[model samples]
Target chain A: MVEFTPDEMMTIAASRLLTNDDVCFVGIGAPSAACNVARLTHAPDITLIYESGTLGTAPNVLPLSIGDGELCDTAVTTVSVPEMFRYWLQGGHVTVGFLGAAQIDKFGNLNTTVIGDYHNPKIRLPGGGGAPEIATSAHQVFITSKQALRGMVEAVDFYTSLGHGTGGNDREDTYGVKTKGPTVLITDLAVWKPDPETKEFTVVSIHEGVTRDDLQATCGWSIKYAQDVRETPVPTELELNTLRDLQSRTAIAHSL
Target chain B: MSLQDAVAKYIKDGQLIALEGFTHLIPHAAAHEIIRQGRRDLTAIRMTPDIIYDQMVGMGCIKKLIFSFMGNPGVGLLKRVRDSIEHEYPSAITYEEYSHSAMANAYEAGAAGLPCAIFRGFLGAELAKVNPNIKHVICPFTGEKLAAVPSVQPEVSVIHAQRANKRGEVLIEGIIGVQKEAVLAAQKAIVTVEEIVDDFDDMHPNTCILPHFVVDAICVVPGGAHPSYSHNYYQRDNAAYKEWAAISADRDLFAKWMEDNVMSVGPEVFEGRVAHLRGAK
Candidate 1:
């Protein structure tokens, strides 16, 4: 079995954060992969809810999206967008809302908007399908994205998802947004958490061979890192091989 | 007012466009205009890229598609993109199954001019490979990078607004950013409205959504935003959406329907059709 390039790092980090009892709201792509990994590996009993209405889905392969046939295949029950949000996600059935972002800010606010002015802008982007609700209603949000200065900015153009809600994040209290807006942002660089006082994000740890200054300089605002950071453990070869093999096979299947 | 004229007035060939409304909301009238014009080899980017993708693919109007979700909730499979890939149509179909949160982050990242946004998703999961075209971008700041995103600048966008002027100043609410961002990101746009409001002060200035200055074409067609609600105007027809979902497959039937309805109808005639549907109602 071959290992994916990021599988080793991804598996180790994902497994460490997840617990067996956690009910996760799974997205498509990488988020789907991670949730399934947790189910297959450490968190075998983890309850996974997909946006497309699959409740407690246990697919052998990752689904393409919430619409994947695999999600509706034998091992699943059904739900609706409204029901999924109310009963499964906002109903307090889920503990973690796993998401990914296109752009992130120092305050942890995100933007799925355009780069320039509000009207007559430059590019057209996909409007929030369910992000607003997911961001504001999930128990707690766990964000994942590839690390880059362009994405990890000081401010985002629009608040596509209510990650922190302008620092007054009343999500959990007022909206029952299960997650604390965005509790953590896991990337290739390092792990990040919100500052207790400011509610802004602060780098908690850098992966092996990554430096502290490097992480700080990437932000558009004056970034800070957690005081006590620790080194992450290396991933097992078995996990790595499985991830790699899955990716290669998927690539062949999708022809990407 | 003929399909050819409608296509000329509202739709353009080979443009990165936005179809208005929601999953079951807007009918994507302008997208149909594009099909009637026989505009081929186009790239469309949007959320759930359905009606547009399906019609474009079936009609061969779309050469490639970049989208987050492209399927109906429980009506079966991702028929369009999957079928294209499976058949090896020589047409490229890129599927980005990013969660709403993740896609927003990517768009945010692209808008911010940052390389990537950090979030928790299914990391070390199987899709890291299945959709392999997704690349890893190095973080310029931290010297750490993964799947960094580039800014997406759409050339044209077609949307349905509650109200618009002859010049195409649109008005929407709640998630104005969605409309605002699409306007800002694309080079040009077409605004199709149910009503052409006389004054801009009708909806709070802040909620103007998209200004007329950016709009190249402002086609005033009452009830044109069928499928997608025009703010306070109308609500989505769930029955029609169900019908659409059921027939998303059966390419031949859809193509023929397009020829009979959208392709045969004129721009001015859209009004008559909407009135008919309402009259029947």
Candidate 2:
């Protein structure tokens, strides 16, 4: 049984959204963990694509980068960086973009560009790698975060990743960009989805140990907890155990 | 002023080079310059260095590559890069697990001038042993020696910064110190800055790094970083990089860009390319 951390739990919730037959555009950190966990558990059949040129890789252990040996060692195949984007991602082969962001907004928009303005930034973070493309290419997108007031913000300093900028496909509509909307947002507090009409973030469920007020207080924008919000199913002991064991293995390698 | 000449100043045959710019921070100019110059049999290290690395592999400028991610941000990974790795590239590009950890491991190790730094990533990871550039080495400083290490110290380091003097005295926003680490450790350093300042004194003394004495020369490539943000200078040209990404997908497109840009000139000519793209007079 896997005993998942709240952070890992958040990743798990994000992973649950994946299907056995998903071609996921994966990011490097938490999203990578969640996607790999899903591949290890229920969604073993999922095809994982990383910006680093690995396609359909299912490693036994988590990788440090897209170039990690496990990805190639366990990969079903690898493609060129250009092919990953043109032939697959932009070509609409990717079904889901599994990603993570430093800051999020009500519209499921992500910001990894800066903490402040785009030009005069407060903190210039790693700009969008393949994020902007994934945000604009995949048929559907899922975000994994450890929900906090700092990370889940009222607004982003810069739009590093354009998931649902402003509201209601505003980014896609105004931009003529194809791809699916940011279908889900998974955080520590709960899993949330955009309101159909307004496209604002609305809670769908509270994590096992969270509350409605908890969600409201942590949000930067006006919050909306799901009326039909159900309790997050607890991670089974097996799930917890396996995940922790994997984490420990990951920890052993990444431990500084 | 051509890539052929610019590359000669910083690179040589059989050396390893680490190109900078994270996702879209500083565009990798010198690496592209190297490829354009037609140098070969080199190795590279990166966490994620957009298409320049792919361009390097495609041009056969590299013998081996250690990286976490490589692609044209929006387009995809390079086809030749895949071929080199899968079918054996004249130079190979290998994959790893974490980006920051890889950078941190190599950066910190190089920063400290140690042989290698120990990290607890997934145990006995396969990527750790992929290349000798980063391997289990005795901590030159600690002498205590650790196992499971990843060290990335290139013989030469090329990065793009927002500002610099003609002598290559440079400044980058945020003081991430990644540049500092690279600057301190590398045998030689080449920086393509957004602007070339006349006087080092004009910039704050504290903000300055890679003193003119240590620098070779600075090329005022303006938008040298291209797809990347120029550290308080500008944001990434997602549209441009997206175009580069798409171009990377097709050899014809990539080759067209290569023939026109990379093969045409040196660092001095970089601004003209940007001007061409922007249609500036």
Candidate 3:
């Protein structure tokens, strides 16, 4: 009984998906936290590459921004932005592109651009940085976001990153996207995996204490559950302590 | 050379300008100089249009913004950017948006003296549809389709670095972003440094050095990249970035902030702002 918040559970679950062999292109925010947590715990050898060009960085405290001096100081190597985007990312060296988005569709397409029309927007969001290329160039993609009806939308206003276009093999067949887009979606309420045949995201495991009603309430689309959905295991003591320690250190470092 | 003279000599109204630094070593002091000089109708370019760009945009200095991402780094939304794009506050501005990859490659292409950059990107994304710059080309070598965009050739490019030698050669260390490419791609380049030393005797082998031939002017402005760290010199002013979220939310407050901090100050003011954060390493 270590107590953990839903956000902590989501981060831990996302971290568990990474392995030592994976070279992850990390987005800032929750994805960065998850990737670093994995390095601190199970996947010690995971290569963490920030878009600012820090490669294999092992920072003790989380960076407030991607190009923090800590990332460069702790990195195995730092390359120029052009070389980073061209030779490393677009060259297909990254195994996973961990991302966070403002809105997601049933097919897992993302929208970080705007909340409404392209010409006129209800809310003009921070547009896609490296996501468009990372989504296609990485071997696979993993998405983490807090669950809400507005975020889990029926359709994205803009496709900032192609996840699985219109379901099925559309990402590969139609767009010639060479990578597996959005294989997993980890949220506060549940763990979702794309269907093998259709590529539509389906809930495979609900987090502890979250019911079908909870999932249905947060999601915009009609809920689809796997036949044998299971409860996600609670966080282990080691995982809890490691995560808390990392977060506290990050808070202190950023506060300065 | 002085920062004021460099900016005054190289920059002009309604010109394409790029002030590039990823998250580190952003040319904040130079940007403030641009604002103070009241340069209007300029086209600003950057991969991540951080706080400096936000300040410029809010002050009605820019007419067009050609960028990839617009935010306050890890803090939150850049409210001024949102205000301009969403409500046309201050003034209506046009946007030429692209992914970070495309913008980086575009700069690379510009540096290499090419017309357009061809890459495998924007496959299923909506950016291809909105940005007319994001075109498509068929690779003659392999018949594979790819995205293409015109090279980013800025009329003037400015960057902040750690140090420079008296010979006017600039040395940039730690997180060497697209500064080199941006400088090469621009018609004119200005570099602001923390200090000038005799030579780079004990520099790291991998450090980027801009030969004096490529650099148009060099100005020594210590702590020029405040709010954004200068690698070994100072830590990032995260509190200022967080405070900006609220300060820029209100139009009048943003105006007042500019008037107090930027409109009335010279480049020398930067050193005082980050005196405590020096020797951060």
Best by TM-score: 3
lDDT of 1 at B213: 73
Which whole-number lDDT from 0 to 100 does residue B85 have in model 3?
84
State the fnat of model 2.
0.00
Q: For residue B249, what is the lDDT in candidate 3?
A: 95
lDDT of 1 by residue, B1-281 (tens): 23245457655666666653333225366766676677876777665666556667766777667655455432334454445645634255544444443444444444355555444332222223334434455556776434433445567766666666544566753222234445555666666666776777655544545666776666666666554334344433334545665465565666567778677885566565445234211
Using lDDT, give the best candidate's number: 3
- The Cα error of candidate 3 at residue B237, in Å, is 0.7
lDDT of 2 by residue, A14-130 (tens): 777888989998887778878877887888899998764578887766765454445655666655343455567657888998888888888877766457654333554544556
Per-residue lDDT of B145 in model 3: 94
Candidate DockQ scores, in order: 0.04, 0.03, 0.92
Total backbone collisions, model 1: 51
Query: Tens digits of per-residue lDDT for model 2 on B177-251?
Result: 256566666777776777767757756655536677655555557767664445355434445654655666566
- Write down the TM-score for model 2: 0.52
Best DockQ among the predictions, by candidate number:
3
* Candidate 3 structure quality by residue, lDDT tens digits, A1-256: 5788999999999999999999999999899989999999999999999999999999998889889999999999999999999999999899999999999988889999999899988999999999999999999999998999999999999999999999999998999887888999999989999999988899999899999999999999997877789998888998888888999999998888
